[model samples]
Structures are given as structure tokens and as C-alpha cells.
Target: MKNRTIDYILRATWQAVSRMYNEEAIKYDASMAIAFALLSIDREGISSTLLGPNMGMEATSLTRTLKKMETKGLILKEKNPNDGRGVIIKLTPLGLEKRELSKAKVKRFNEMIRANVSDEKIRHFIEVTDVINELINNKTIFEK
Candidate 1:
């Protein structure tokens, strides 16, 4: 039987989700990237180096986002005591409030999906995703 490529399906699904988030974020005068960044940070702080990897973001893009967030008083950067060369991203009071709103939006989206999708299907989806990740990480994707 003919079928669509797995990569195409993945990309399409993600694009749809991103568009949906961007639309929702507009209502709060926020963007998906901003909400995602806020979600990635810890209450105390998160290391700049660690943040990029956690969010799968490029250094330049992340830097720009952080700068905007700081400008908006959503976050602050302080010297990391443990690493003088690095900084910690700390959410401000306003940042905390926004983060909570982001959290609720994320929960709402996930709950909507979970309510519609069966548990068994979700489990299979997770299993497939994990296997795909493992294959790529292990460089086994093209193995004969």
C-alpha cells in the first residue's frame, strides 16, 4: 500500500501544533517561543548553556529571545555563582505569573488530546517515538 513518509507526517503534525499555539498565544500577547522558554526555566533559575539544549534552540535565537524577555521584565540574568562564565535565567514576578498561564495552556492542550485519544494508542505512539529517537541517536536509521 502507498503511504506518506514518516518524516513528512512528523513535520506536518508539528507545524499544525505550532500554528495552533501561535494563534492561542496571540490572545495573551505572547508567542510560542516565549511561553516555551518560560516553561523551560526553573523557578530559581536555569543555566544558559543548559537552557538551549533543553529547548533544542539555536544559541543566536535563544539569545535574542532572552534579551526580549529581559526587556519585557519577564526574566533576569544573573552571574552563575558556580560558573563565572555563565549566567542563570531567573523569572521575575511577572515572569512567574506568565509562566503559570503558559502552564495552563499546555495542560489544556494535552488534556484535550488525552481525552480524545485512547490510552493504548497513546502508549503505542510513545513507544514508536522512543524507538525512532533511539534509532537516530544510535545511528541505526540506515542500518541494513
Candidate 2:
């Protein structure tokens, strides 16, 4: 194509970043998905139902990831007393350690980007993304 569309650019950039993170994660016997799930979990724990939406993951996908984490002794699932049918996910010590690693990787990436890009440009990028999200969320991008 002579000109790349905005969605194409966004998708391509995300794919590149995802690949980079996954490569890094491989060294620790983890994947980008696991790191993301670790980062999404709160210290106090998060509801199994809420975690999926928070991470923008499908229920089945999140279930699989959580199962792997559990098998790795990275997370613990406990029944929610208030809601018997619900489960709360809490991180283990190993999970906390991994979470720090994920945080550092993200922080380093942000720092590297900040070192190369001007704050004004970053702010503009954020503003544009915010507008895009708003448009999608409001269903304003297409006629009903």
C-alpha cells in the first residue's frame, strides 16, 4: 500500500512490541501473556471475573493463563466468601518476583522511549489514542 492506515500502523507496532516482550519472557520460562496476567493482578487479589475484563482477555484465555500460573506456583485461587461462586486470585511469592521483573521491563521500555521522544509528542500520541478509544467505546466510528 502506498499509504498505511492508522489501524494497520497500530496493529503492526503492537505486534512488534509483543514479539519483543515475548522474546524477553522466554528467558524466564514465561510468556508475554503470563507477564501481563501477573501485572494485572492486584496485591490484594482480583476477582476471577474482573481480571479477564481488566486485561481485555477472553474468559477461556484468561482461564488457561491462570491455570498455568497456578501450576507454576505463581498464583493461588481462593473462593470468595462473599460470593461462593466467585474466585479471587492472589499472587504467590514467585508471582510477586515475576511481577517485579515485568514492571522493570516495562519501566525500562518507557524510559528508553522517553529518552528518544519529546514529551510533547508522547502527550499527543496519548491524546490521539484516548480519542480513538473514546470513539470506539461510544460506537461513534460507524453509523448504527
Which candidate leads in lDDT? 2
Candidate 1 lDDT tens digits, 31-129: 899999999998988999999999999999999999889988999999999999999999999999999999999999999999999999999999999
What C-alpha lDDT, on a 0 to 100 scale, does residue 113 get in candidate 2?
94
Q: Which stretches in model 1 have alpha-carbon errors above 4 Å?
A: 1-3
Model 1 residue 47 distance off true place after TM-score fit, in angstroms: 1.0
> Lowest summed-lDDT stretch of 10 residues in model 2?
1-10
Instruction: Kindly report which residue pairs in candidate 2 clash with one another.
Output: none
Q: State candidate 1's TM-score.
A: 0.94
Q: How accurate is candidate 1 locally (lDDT)?
A: 0.94
For all predictions, the C-alpha RMSD in Å is: 1.6, 1.2
After TM-score superposition, the amount by which residue 102's alpha carbon in candidate 2 deviates from its true location, in angstroms, is 0.6
Give candidate 2 regions above 4 Å deviation: none
* Tens digits of lDDT, candidate 2, 3-80: 398998899999999999999999999999999999999899999989999999998999899999999999999999
